[model samples]
Target: MKVLVTGAAGFIGSHVSLYLLERGDEVVGLDNLNDYYDVNLKLDRLKRVEQHKNSYNFSFVKVSVEDKEAMENLFEEHKFDKVVHLAAQAGVRYSLENPHAYIDANIVGFMNILEGCRHNQVKHLVYASSSSVYGANESMPFSVHDNVDHPVSLYAASKKANELMAHTYSHLFNLPTTGLRFFTVYGPWGRPDMALFLFTKAILEDKPIKVFNYGNHKRDFTYIDDIVEGIIRTLDHTAEANPEWSGKDPDPGTSKAPWRVYNIGNQSPVQLMEYIETLEDSLGKKAEKELLPLQMGDVPDTYADVEALVKDVDYRPQTTIQTGIGNFVDWYKDYFKVK
Candidate 1:
């Protein structure tokens, strides 16, 4: 199969592309390489993907999904069997500073992806959605069937809008679309803006890490390998219309069309402080914590209910925080040539 992976230079996208390439799939990776966090890191990730021992028939293109002409041309040229749309302006706090970035990247970019998939007869469209969509719900274990109409940030709103847009395309064009609401995904080659990366870098450098929510926040910190596995499984298991779907009591996670949403998380929530402690243990160092109130567009906790994903894919993300942190630390030290 030929797969199109947008944001292929990104944290999860790079891993996903490598996984596909290893599985003997022809992969066309695309990324604009924007300076969201670090363009050098993005380039390094792509370089790693290119240099992977298992990589074969893998090629990358520098393109932005927001450009309709470029996207159209690429879709027309490749005619990809499947698309993993992971490109978006990521970060809740950053969305507050530059809301238009979210509009341009998450909204307009996703529009182009949907259009490309629709026109090119793509078999499956698997896109990245965020757990932040469950904003203000206060649910213990966030379920896919629950209402997600209230998003706290423009980033979350854009993701919710993507789900709605996917449903529309699924209903009208018979597109098989699946949205995976990812929790706090962390691992090797992770985003510098993410908690694990930031915390690890700060702690290693003897800098004080800002403990948000006063270290009270709990997150379902999922490993990247587990996420990539779930993505591959979901991509293989193309979404189908739910026979039992009812409009009277509609489920937000599924539709009568070939559309579905799943929360890909570890299911086990770890406290913020506990996560930091795990990282400290991994690095053989202690972090100087500066406890602070939670920032705007931030949630106190996130626990994903992945029962739907388990039932459908027969898989669950079981990577422990300790193990995940250890792997990340090893990667960080090796990548940065730190002692």
Candidate 2:
């Protein structure tokens, strides 16, 4: 299978590309390598994938998805069996600042992806959605069946729009589109903007980490390995039109067309402070905390209801926060040479 992975230079996208390569699949990696956080870190992830260039099938292209001509040309060149659309302008707080980035990448870019898949006869299109779509919803465990019309940030709004756009394509052209609403994904080679990476860096430098929501927040912190596993499983299992679905009382998760959505998460939400403590233990350093109110476009808690994912793909994110943090700390030490 020739798999096209957008955002292949990103933290999760790079890992997904490697996993596909290892499983005897050809991969065409694409990314703009924009400095959303740090371009060097993104390139470092690409370097790790390049190490497997000998046996595994892998090719990389430096292009943004927003470029309609480049994206259409790439699709015309390679009739990809499957596409993992992981590229997008990611970051909640950053969305508050540069809202146009979200529009260009998440909105316009995703539209291009849907268009390419429609015309090129792609088999499956699996794109990355986020748990941030559960904005302002106080549901105990965020479910795909729940209404997600209220997104606090433009980033979240763009992701929600992606799901809708995918559904429209699936319905109109009968494209198989699956949207995975990912929780807080973290591990080795994570984005510097993410909480774990920032907290770890701050703690190591004896800097005060801003404890958002006064450390009262809880997150379903998912490991990269688990995320990759779920993605592979989903890619293999292309979505199908639900037989029992009806328009009268429509199911939010499944559609009459081959469109679907699922929550990819640990199912267990951990406190923000507890995660910091785990990181501290891993690095043998205590973080100086500066408690602060939650920033705009931020949610107080995020707990994913992954029952649908578990039932469909046997996707159970089993990495404990302690173990995952330890693995990340080891990688950080090796990557940065922190003595």
Candidate 3:
């Protein structure tokens, strides 16, 4: 199968691309190599993908998803069998600082992807959504069935908008679209902006790490491998219209059209302090902690109810925090030459 993976140099995108290539699938990876965090890290991920000992064809293109002309040309040229759209301006607090970035990347970029899939006859379109969409809903174990009308940040709102837009395309064009609301994903080659990476770096450098919400937050941290596995499984499972769906009682997760949404996350939610401690243990260093109130666009906790995903894919994230943190620390030490 020929596939197009946007954000291929990104944390999750790189891993997913590698997985596809190793399985003998032709993959065209695209990324703008933006300076959201570290361009060097993104380049390094691309290098790894290219150097992987895989039998399949793999290529990387430097293209921004927001560019409609480039995206349309690429879609028309490749006629992709499947597309994994993971590119987006990610970060809750950053969204507060630069709202326009979210609009350009998440909203406009996603529109191009939807259009590409619609015109190119893509078999399946699996795009990234976020657990942040469950904002302000004081519900434990966030489920896809739950209504996520209230979003605290523009980032969350953008992701929710992507779902809505995807539904529209699926309804109007009969395109099969699936949105995966990923929980906190962390592992080797993880983004520098993420808490796990920041905490690990700060602790190793003997710098103070900020404890958000006064160390009261709980997150369902899913491992990178598990997330890639879920993505592959869902990509293979083309979405179909839910016959039981009704207009009178609409389910936000599934629709009468060929569209569906599922939460991809570890069922376990770990306290922020516990996560910090795990990182400290992995690094063999203690971090100076500055306990602070939750910043704007932040939530106290996130726990994913992945029952629907488990029922459909017959798989669930099983990586423990200890193991995941250990793997990350090992990778960090090796990648950055941390003595």
Candidate 4:
């Protein structure tokens, strides 16, 4: 199958692209290579994909999803069989500082993707949502069936809006849209803005790492490989309308239209302190911690209920935090030449 992957140079995008290529799928990668964190890191990730197996099956283009003309042209030219829309302005705390970026990237960019998929007659549209959408809900394990109308952060709001927009398209055009609400994704080649990367960097440099929510926050840190596996399974299994769905008692996860949402996570929430300790063990260095209150637009905890995902797609998260962190530390040390 021929697939289009937005945010191809990003952390998850890069891995997803490689995974598709490895599975003998033709992939057209797209990314603006924005300096949200480090453009060099993005470039290196792309290089790694290009150097790996099935490199000939992968092609890349530089473009932003918000650019309507560019997106339209690409869609018309490529006519992708499916699309994995992972491109978005990501970061809960950063959304509070620069809200417009979220609007342009997450909102407008997603509009362009939906339009492209709708016109191109794409078979499946698997896009990334967020665990943040379950904002202010103290549910033990965040489930797709739960109402997510109350998102505390603009980032979360933008994701929720994407799900709504996707449902509209699925209803109107009979498009098959599947939204995966990802929990805290981490592993090798992760975003510098993410907790694992930040903590690792700070710890390596003997700097103090800020422990948010006074180290009380719990996160279901899903590994990158597990996430890619779930993504591939979802991409292959196109969404179908739930015949049991009724407007009288509509389910938030499934619709009468060909739209669905699922939580893609490890299904095990670990405390912030425990996560850092795992990292410390991986790096053989102790972190200097500065306990701090939770930042605006941040949730205290996120635990994903991936039962639907497992039942539907046979998705399973196999990596533990210790193993994931150890893999990350090895990659980090090798990539940065850390002794």
TM-score of each: 0.99, 0.98, 0.99, 0.99
Candidate 1 TM-score, C-alpha based: 0.99
Residues 1-339 of candidate 4: C-alpha lDDT, one tens digit per residue: 999999999999999999999889999999999988999999999998898789999999999999999999999999999999999999998988999999999999999999999999999999999999999998778989999999999999999999999999999999999998998999999999998999998999999999989999999999999999999999999999999999999899999999999898999999999999999999998999999998888888899889999899988686899999999999999999999
Winner by lDDT between candidate 4 and candidate 1: 1
What lDDT is obtained when candidate 1 is compared to the true structure? 0.95
Off by over 4 Å in 4: none
Q: Please, what are the lDDT tens digits per residue for candidate 1 over residues 1-339?
A: 999999999999999999998888999999999998889999999999999876768989999999999999999999999999999999999998999999999999999999999999999999999999999999789999999989999899999999999999999999999999999999999999998989989988899999988999999999999999999999999999999999999988898999999999999999998898888889999999999999999999999999999999999999998888899999999999999
Candidate 2 deviant stretches above 4 angstroms: 53-56
Error of 1 at 21 (Å): 0.5
**Worst ten-residue run, lDDT, model 4?**
310-319
Query: Candidate 2 — what's its lDDT?
Result: 0.92
Clashing pairs in 4: none
Q: For residues 141-222, what per-residue lDDT tens digits would candidate 3 score against the true structure?
A: 9999999999999999999999999999999999999999999999999999999999888888888999989999999999
